[model samples]
Target: MMSSVINALSVDIEDWFQVGAFESTLDRADWPSFEHRVERNTDAVLAMFDDAGAKGTFFTLAWVAERYPALIRRIVAAGHELASHGYDHQRVFTLSAEAFRADLRKSRRLLEDAGGVAVTGYRAPSFSIDQQTPWAHAVLAEEGYAYSSSVAPVRHDHYGWAGSPRFGWRPVDGSGLLELPVTTARLAGRTLAAGGGGFFRMLPYEFSRWAVRQVNAEGHPAVLYFHPWEIDPGQPRVPNAPLRSKVRHYANLSAMEGKLRRLLRDFRWGRVDALVEGMTA
Candidate 1:
């Protein structure tokens, strides 16, 4: 059965080499040396969404936007929401409150200027906001961001708050900012990652389909995210990256587009801003 709910779809607009998995092997200073495939890959994503007649958010990095202003314009021209994914893809927990604020301001400014739209939504790199960054929400509100999708409420090795709210809520007292967590589904008393990522590629498509249905059956929108690099199987590989990172980054790269197309056809998807407005309304 098709879900009556309209889920939120998002693309984390970054290149293959810029992923966290390659952070150890690649340095920020040498980022310019890598082959720039973000434009080509994101164009593929936009084409897919266009074919599906879907409009979603693009959580763009200022680094990418600064280098590829034309790409930012294309995203905006296609009627997708342009949101911030920070300046350089740094995790919130890794930065102090002041540094985080600085990142927020810089990213929001760069993205807004590049896309010519109000950047109000943020998704921390790697879903990095958790209990340790209790002040994050307050800073987001102060910085004029209306909402965030930075928290993944599941137990994971890298980034998950585990016990955070499963849906959108005001994380800070007296603040209107909303934290829209990446979707998770309960199965056999365990919280599993239902949202997109390497997990979506690693796990069977049937499981993801069931998970989205599970969330929709409960009367909430499923927020799914994926990077442009996920569909690029021919991307240059980092030989020095750890085996775990390589597996996570390389597994099912060729299969992502097909899975994503199926998911889009199976469920209704829209921008996160629309989802946030509906939840608040």
Candidate 2:
């Protein structure tokens, strides 16, 4: 691994049931009734980061922050960056401009108060920021977020900002927000999604590794993200999940931790804030 190439590592901190996969089957009000696996699962991730001597950003939900204040503090105490993952894991586009602004404000306050640190970064739930939600950038900047890693350029059914930049760039029509789309790679003249999530699990681990290498070789920082649930195979399953949701959410779960270990060992990992600072400098 090249010592100079430090990629951004992030985790979207939400419980298994809170994931969008169970949106159809699980109701938000019923969240309290389900098992709260985020604390234990996130601690497992913290231990992995410690073993690797790596730091990352945790884009945690305010709902989770209020319920698990100690976990937020624990992330900060371990030298990891903490950022808002919005108030209730709702998609940004799904909310009105006023609603999104409120979400950002409330989440930032909760995270900052709980983590005892400034929250300057955000990642929208499920990367839901798109052209329809251009107002999001200005609102995010106005609310004091310094940067966002919320848009994936790839075309997915639920979310995507197709033709967006794969690396960091400022919006021309949106706002002064510094946008860092998920890391991707060009292969055979077509851009492929490489930044972790379900894609990281669905694809061969070696392919994910190569995609990051490809991005770095092109002199761009690769930003990889994962959910703590992705590493916990034994998590309670969302029974009666739709076929598509089941396939994407449960694919190769048992093998994810090993791939994560390889990722931490094969590349330099750092916080998203560090990358932003470097870019600004």
lDDT of each: 0.92, 0.90
Off by over 4 Å in 1: none
TM-score computed on alpha carbons, candidate 2: 0.97
For model 1, residues 1-281, the per-residue Cα lDDT tens digits are 78789999999998888888887889999999889999999999999999999999999999999999999999999999999999988889989999999999888888888899999899999999998898888999998888999999998888899889999999878877899999999988999988999989989999899989999999999999999999999999888889999999999999999999999999999999999988888
Model 2: per-residue Cα lDDT over 31-145, one tens digit each? 9998888999999999999999999999999999999999999999999999889988899888999999988889988998999999999999989989889788888888867
TM-score of each: 0.99, 0.97
Model 2: runs farther than 4 Å from truth?
Answer: 1-3, 172-176
- Candidate 1 collision pairs: none
